[model samples]
Target: MTEYMPIMLDVRDMRVLVVGGGRIAGRKARQLAEAGADITLISPEAEPEIRELEAAGTLRWLRREASEEDVDGYRIVYAASGDETLNERIAEAARRQGALVNAASRAQAGNFIHPAVLRRGRLIVTASTSGAGPSAASALIRELDERFGDEYETYAEFLYFMRKKVRETVIEPETRHRLMRKLAETDILDQIRQDTFVPWSETEAAAWIEREREE
Candidate 1:
């Protein structure tokens, strides 16, 4: 068994082919569409959501069964036809053509597995069970969703601005490290949970750092 490695792909404007028209294919198509991929779904039948996207011209629809040729000129291919034999053929074709393939029916058949991911602005958290139990992975994602609320989102944004400001204002490397250490020790999330404003300004962050050092 191959060890599953986690990675994020930049799918913007990439050509993605989804071989299926059922619910599974529709779900995959929707996700790829949301990621700004040029999705082409090949299936004889489509779910209601797929039809809506097709009608709205958000995605291209081919009312025909998938073939090896469908993998051609595509950056990524997803085989979710629910047929083991068909999915295997798709995967083989994608491999021979040097295209990345994802077989939703069998994770072992594909090179990668899609993880349950939650995104908040620049913060992205993903969970996977190596394709053993997708349901369990989904459950874990839900649990994380409940435990880590919007505070994490705000914290990520705060860090982004802080890093940029540090580059612009703090010239000394030692000074920058000191400031970052102080920010890390201040427990900004705890303060946010306690209903305090997230201090993003240099002066506010410095004050919080001083208070933490005194404690």
Candidate 2:
């Protein structure tokens, strides 16, 4: 078994092919499209939700069985026809075309694998068992979701804004890192989760920066 090297690819404007119309295929296609890929789904028939996306012009839908020709021009290919044999065959053709292929039934057959993910705006947490156990990864993700509430997304965005400002304000690189780390370790996340946080104000951040400079 090949060890998977984890990566978060930016699929924006990349040509992605999904060669199945089943629910799992549809879900994977939707995630690709949501990430700004130019998605083309080739399946004789697709799940209702995927068909709806086609209707909405979110993706190009080829209402036909996948052929070798369908693999051309795709940067990424997802083989998810639910037939393990067919998926592997599709994976073979896609790899020949120099496309990175992900087969639903067989992780080792593909160059890449997906981890269970939780997202809150710019914040994303991923759980993976290194292809050892997907169900365990999913369970771990669910547990993390319980621990990190939706408010964490807002917390992430807030930190993004502040961190950028800190970079601009704190001229010293080491000082900026210390200030950012200090802010992250504070009770802010807890306060947000408990709904006891004052409406976020840059005033507190400014004060903290000043105090850090003094110390």
Candidate 3:
């Protein structure tokens, strides 16, 4: 069994091939499309949903059986044809041809595992169990979804905006560090969650730090 390492990939404008058109393949294809990959999906027959996306030109459709040649020239490939032997074969060929693969059945043939991901505006969370406990991972996501709501979206963005201002204004490393932590500790995020947050000026956020420095 391969111990998988988790990392995010920048697939924008990258070529990705999905070797199936069933429901499973359609789901993965939709996700890759959302991540901005230039997708080519190959299948002799496809679900109506996948065909609908193809009709819209969201991804190029190759209405044919996938071959080893189809596995080449792609940055990433999804082996999801539901045929165990062919899926494994495609995974092996994809790896040999220098492409990352996400296999629906076999884990060892691929380099990475996909975890259950939760994305809020700027807050993204991923839960996985090394592919052993997918149910547990999904249950954890439900718990997290309840605790972290839309409030986190605005709160996270606010913190980022203020961090940049602190970088430019706060010269002392120690003082800058303290202010960054303080910004989070203040009731600001709570305010954002409750829909009571008001935008603050640069001096408004940094004023207390200036006071401490002068003292």
Evaluation by lDDT, superior candidate among 1 and 2:
2
| lDDT score at residue 85, model 2, on the 0-100 scale | 85
Best-fitting candidate, scored by lDDT: 2
Off by over 4 Å in 2: 170-172, 202-207
Estimated TM-score per prediction? Answer: 0.83, 0.87, 0.85
Model 1 — TM-score against the truth? 0.83
How close to the true structure is residue 95 of candidate 1, measured as C-alpha lDDT?
A: 83
Model 3: clashing residue pairs?
Answer: none
User: Which RMSD values do the candidates have, in order?
Assistant: 3.7, 2.2, 2.8
Model 1: number of backbone collisions: 0
Candidate with the greatest TM-score versus the true structure: 2
Per-residue lDDT of 97-142 in model 1, one digit per residue for the tens?
Answer: 8888899888887788889988877889999988888999999999
Task: Let me know the TM-score candidate 3 reaches against the reference structure.
Answer: 0.85
After TM-score superposition, the amount by which residue 142's alpha carbon in candidate 1 deviates from its true location, in angstroms, is 2.4
Residue range with the least summed lDDT across 10 consecutive positions in model 3: 206-215
Give the clashing residue pairs of candidate 2, or none.
none
lDDT of 3 by residue, 107-194 (tens): 7667667888777887889899888888899899999999888888888788788878878887889877887877777898777767
